[model samples]
Target: MMSTATAIQERSLLGLKHLSREDILAILDRASYWEQQSEKLVPILNKKFAVNMFFENSTRTRFSFEMAQKRLGVQVMNFTAAASSVEKGESIYDTVRTLESMGVDAGVVRLKPSGVLQELAQRVRIPLINAGDGNNEHPTQALLDLYTMRKVFGELQGLTVSIIGDIKHSRVARSNLWALQKLGAKVQFCAPSVMSAPELAEHAPYVSMEEALKADVVMMLRVQLERHSGGLFQSSEEYREQYGLTEERAASLLGHTIIMHPAPVNRNVEIDDAVVECDRSYIFRQMAHGVPVRMAVMERAMRD
Candidate 1:
């Protein structure tokens, strides 16, 4: 039999823009299959080795990918920049090439630079999955978000999803905007003037917070304070008043409208604490769906 690592030598998942509508649906279908097989651990990736190389810090994306690998029976190596020679000025290309030389089948990479993942993809021979790349994209998160919505609504067409807050600094928002639009969902952006991006006007029109709340789905983005230099907002209190999903706002939404956040929630800043636990909130459920969606991605990436 061909070695497991060799089977995935030709595949890499860089971004949602690389996938077709049919490709997106097939991955979702695969995720559903994995979800149904939850209780049983299937070892389709037995004897394969994959590495998680996170140049950026993450909790959900990193651990979920690790969990998906373990559940699929793939041996995993975790690489952190601080712990690796990356701290000694080793380039990403050299580091990943070293992993490739070690016979790893695939790599899941999260980097802080926008186009670095694609650059690394070109240099590496094994399959490389982009976990998140700066403000460029987070394809897997978008896929899982879509999968979570599909579980609830059965279809994406005609559903309106309003993404509120920090649009200029969100990889999640960019990925979701592309995927949701391609899947026939109407998307809108709502954010403070400082946080809005000119590019967003091409994909979705900006709407008032009240107008945004009328959508079937409300996705609140955290204030990306780390990525911003300064002056995005004067105060968190003011941001909460204008853009936060307050308890009153959540309560006022239609019964069927749902709430979402790509998490690391800002408590009362981007979304009210109480609103996060409300019946309409599917934030945690979205985290739960990450494993299966990642499983589907890894399985397909490693397939012959």
Candidate 2:
């Protein structure tokens, strides 16, 4: 029989919603192996080719994937909607298919639609990785987040993680919630009624801001104001008082608790500038850990 881990290795990473605990740990274990290597470049995948198709704007995720690919000696191609034939009305499938026809071994994709990635995964022969897909999931980001958390707490079996902010539109929150729970951590959400995802209530409960700060990890999400229409909050200042990680809230967290954010953070909006680089903040560390986690992911994607 093909083992579950073997089965997992053969597929595209669409989301973490269906990933098992063992599968997640295996990837994290691989990430740890990559992190410990002293060599700056490992030519394990010297001749392989991979293309990054991003229909949306991004910085960290895109750059991290590029760095990870180069370290493994993979030939990389970058595609953005604004610069590609996509701007002339080419469909996403056509763009990916075009790239696949050009001899790419795998694809790392980020787009604005929710269900399109799953559909693309089925249509494409090369392994497809979900970088971010609307409000659906950002599996690699969650894996790195899990990697960071494990480094601190040593295990996820009983850790408490509170994800606070624009939950309705956050792929980060969805990805973290699914991955965290599968690894035995308790996950909770704290978003204003307008910002909460009604569909997620069955998986995790929404809590008060005061209650959220008490967790072993307080993950403040980026408040996606561009995704909001109107009547969400009076202004950024108001959101700061109610939902942002203000200095007062940081002071109230338990001594062992750590602060995290999936960055491109609105410094004074979703989190205060002072608390961003404070002792307990792992915001930047998360960025550093991303390279290894994604290196593991890209390596796995190209494996037969």
Candidate 3:
């Protein structure tokens, strides 16, 4: 019950690999239309059942999905590790099967181990949608991020974007890289050697922070403080010197460039406080799209 996905799971989505480039564009296009809709949110997901199985904690993404599903009238059954049988030795595979037997149409999962979700999807009768899987992928977040970019920049192809910060541990980085690449954007990574994303090197040929900032878009990723290990850095100052996006660095970027970020920003660590208040920053817009992007995800996944 781990690693690669199978036909059972292929019935849902484990990564973006199952979908074609055109399928990706179609999802975004539909998400845009949903974003413009009115108060009939509750009617959309009616009669459908979606289970939220999160091994890790999340507020924005989880709540956003719940809200979107509720808006669409889908029945949601939420399960968190703290309050679920997971604490009592109920394996993820078993839990998935138990829920599937109850007629759950789809399961939205967010787990810490990469690719574990695909295992669950492969065996389940229901469709599977990954919320976030360790540092592997968070396709929904990427979708919303892409949706936001298209809304602001009007296109993603040829746009240059720098994704800066804890690339080694950030699922956000992994997902965004693929999402941006599929859309034809030039993406760059900027992180400390310890925090640097070797995993991303396979996807990005160009990995310079300075060059990435020269592009049309730059996303500041938060430093994951809770997960940081000892000896990875000599000092916070040193880390900042090598990797932090200070106010001065922000100013050095192109004037017309838009600043982006996925939530829970660590003010002085990955991004300067000044940049959050910057007119060019669209971090907030990313959150706003979470609702609609998820709406599209749920709708498409649950479609009969």
Candidate 4:
């Protein structure tokens, strides 16, 4: 017997910021179940239609959600802003309303403007999953990240995760911060002063790059140079030298420490090429785990 509040909450994943510890764990547990399945396709969601509306460009998140939907046998409609009426100045809300009118069961969305997803969720009739909403949050990414950590450590309790690089512009950092702390994991940030989020200083301490490497998980975010105004650093090489996970820095990490990055990696910018595929790096594993985690999320969104 699910309460009305619980039913609504489970139907849409706007972000992990509001999810309780039990809610987070339940998603992880379900993801583990999906990963264990030997069947290539479950088809439990056959005939259910989902729309992926990407107002912004994406590689991993877009494809991952599509794969997750397909695995469950949900019919998928992918909408790219560049190819749609959005280019002719249609409001995001109008575009969504048009799709909802077409009888979509769910919408997985990514957009450049912050706080708009909340408005959409309020207005839309169908369930909506936040693929990303500006720099506010990327709920599914954080969920997958948590799943990856849980797989390695067996639990989230007592784990220390340091998220390094571009904190001020990272939705991933914010999502991870809220969700990890709720699950009893320690969350820390390591970023240059210019890239640090002053709003979050009260929540997690910003550590130096050297100190950040000691955590159970060292998650490196993309440098996001396109978002910067002027020169944050003189060059990518300099950013690498200062904040990037160089081979030397990677060597100093604890034996139990694991490296991570939510990629579109910068090659040698935020992390060295040598360390990208190193035994301790979980970047690829993170991408691999995104499938099942999202499958769990899609199932939850459409589940009765």
Q: lDDT: which candidate is best?
A: 4
Q: Give model 4's TM-score versus the native structure.
A: 0.97
lDDT of 1 by residue, 169-192 (tens): 889999999899899999999987
Error of 3 at 42 (Å): 4.8
Ranking by lDDT: 4, 2, 1, 3
What's the TM-score of every candidate structure? Answer: 0.95, 0.96, 0.92, 0.97
TM-score of 3: 0.92
- Of 3 and 4, the candidate ahead on TM-score is 4
The TM-score ranking, best first, is 4, 2, 1, 3
Q: Candidate 1 or 2, higher lDDT?
A: 2
Worst 10 residues of 3 by lDDT: 2-11
Clashes of each: 0, 0, 8, 0
Instruction: Give a tens-digit lDDT track for model 4, residues 1-304.
Output: 9865556556999998888888899999999999999997999999799999999999789999999999999999999999999899999999999999999989999999999998888877788999999899999999999999999999889999999999999999999999999989999999988899999999999998888989999999999676675857878888999999999999999999999888878999999999999999999999999999999999999976
Which pairs of residues clash in candidate 1, taking residues 3 or more apart in a chain or in different chains? none
Instruction: State the weakest 10-residue window (summed lDDT) of model 4.
Output: 2-11
The models' CA-based lDDT, in order, is 0.89, 0.92, 0.80, 0.92
Worst ten-residue run, lDDT, model 1?
2-11
Error of 4 at 158 (Å): 0.8
